[model samples]
Target: MDLAAEVAALTDEFSGVVRVDRAGSTVLDAAFGLADRRHGVPMTVGSQVAMASGNKGMTALAAMSLVEDGTLSLGTTARSLLGDDLPLVADDVTVEHLLAHRSGIGDYLDEDVESDIDDYALRVPMQELATTEQFVTVLDGFPTKFPAGERFSYCNSGFMVLALLAERASGTGFHDLVDERVLRPAGMLDSGFLRSDDLPGTAAVGYVRMDGHWRTNVFHLPVRGNGDGGLYTTTADMHRFWVALFAGAIVSPETVALMTTPRSDVPAEGQRYGLGFWVHASRDVLGLSGYDAGVSFRSFHDPVERLTATVAGTTSAGAWPIARLLEERLVTTSPAA
Candidate 1:
């Protein structure tokens, strides 16, 4: 099937966007279904979609950039930077632990401890937990999950601490530092952290299909996104991100290699977690995935074919199927896919 036919089939049941960049060229760039179904606004290549935990990679990169300048060190302790703000965190927890998710700290909305995002947001008033400082007290009353580096357990709070440290080191806010150091350099102009109540024009309004109907997801997220998540971006911009990241435009080539190195060994067979991405050898492609509230995203860059494919959606359910179908097509057509 052609691009249009493939997209139509996916859109018939879902609202989403799929973007493909093959050998530095756009093989497919299309948006299907609606960004705001009530207003009949359709998603476009320029439409902004939430990246959720996808922003973790960007945050990690931002922290590493400061490390490159000697302003911060991977060995720097979170306690030193945060001072009295995060007295609950262990003094030995290093920046590396946070970046690698090995800090084993308590998460405000931990998947293992907490069952659902919707329930968690209800208690906190999603709009109130906007900045890293505002969220510091969430974990203050809770004890550390493990000492500091007992093992790797994904922790949202750890990333928040990293954001605070990054901001302090650069003497700038987390959002501004990322804009100047990472997004601007990568040319991701349409992407930034936004408040839950104030979505910019051309941005997709996330929806959660519940009780056999799609509902807009406003209360399901935080008021403002922080370092760990809550970033809005376009597939075209993400394609540029992968290029800039892998090509060492944002960091040194050695640092890029270090970021891609798998730090934690997953107990599940044949899987590992890198600093900011996931390492999978299913078909010799490196990739990452993020899902939260009403957003779902996945992207892969094939080293052998020099090709990449990314899928993003306003709703969480649409990303995986689109990603799988794109992979199937690419595998059948290319020598390396």
Candidate 2:
């Protein structure tokens, strides 16, 4: 299959960037559609776009770095760290459970099995969620779904607790901890948790299509990112992240192995859950994905082939089709796939 042709055909329907790297070399890099439709800004290769839940990968990395430094352990429990702050969360819900999405804790912004992504309501006002601590108030009301380590269920609130744990352990803010432990060490200088309302010109504005008209996603998400999501990065910075992560620059090799190791199966998606990534065991692929109102992102790295592919879109559903096509092409043609 001609990868370029496949992506070219998607240009009309998708509005974002597609990038692929092989053996630490750039193999493909292309941009499509508008970054800021109102301002007539075209999406560029250098534009930084939001990665909603994709930020979970960095949260996991930050938490694991503390584990590497003997500051925390996978076995550390939320009850032990939080100590009655979140009274309903079970005592057995550990850091490992949260990292692997096995924490049966109730989610504040629960993505119900049948709900539309765009219509999923935020429990709190979007403008109020500025920090991880603020998220704790939102997370407080939901009852625990099941026993800790019972099964795999994606829970955003669990990660918020993990971020709190990291902060307590490191004596640093969650954002600063991630920057110091994950981004800077990975050489991702351009990536950080910037506020949605205050993004600079280099960052793409998120969009959503409503009532046959394009609309900004400014009102659909938190004002600023927390541990669960809302991170912005460039394709080039993500490429550098993959390189540094695999090279054991951010965390130790043993920690990486633990993170990428598949601990549970996600039968619905036909994938497996690792510490913070999705693992395709058959293809030796590791990925981190995110989707929210006016935000879509998928990034993958194949360890054996040293290949990386990323699709980041500024619209809610724009990145999926392109990402799926790329996955099909790579799986059928790439030697590692």
Cα lDDT computed for each candidate against the true fold: 0.79, 0.88
What's the CA RMSD of model 1 in angstroms? 2.3
Question: After superposition on all CA atoms, what RMSD does each candidate show versus the true structure?
Answer: 2.3, 1.3
Give the alpha carbon lDDT tens digit for every residue of 90-185 in model 2.
Answer: 988889999999999998877655677777367678888887788778889788888999899988888899999999888999999999999999
TM-score of 1: 0.92
Question: TM-score of every model?
Answer: 0.92, 0.97
Query: Candidate 2, which ten residues in sequence have the lowest lDDT sum?
Result: 111-120
lDDT of 1 by residue, 1-337 (tens): 7865785677776777788877767888888888888999888878888888888888988999999999999999998888787677888999999998888777766756645543335356666687777777665655688877788888777778888999888899998888998899899998898776888777888888777888878878777788888888888888888888877889898888888888877765355677777665445466767788688887777766777787888786678788778767775457753
**lDDT, model 2:** 0.88
Ten residues in sequence with the least summed lDDT for candidate 1: 114-123
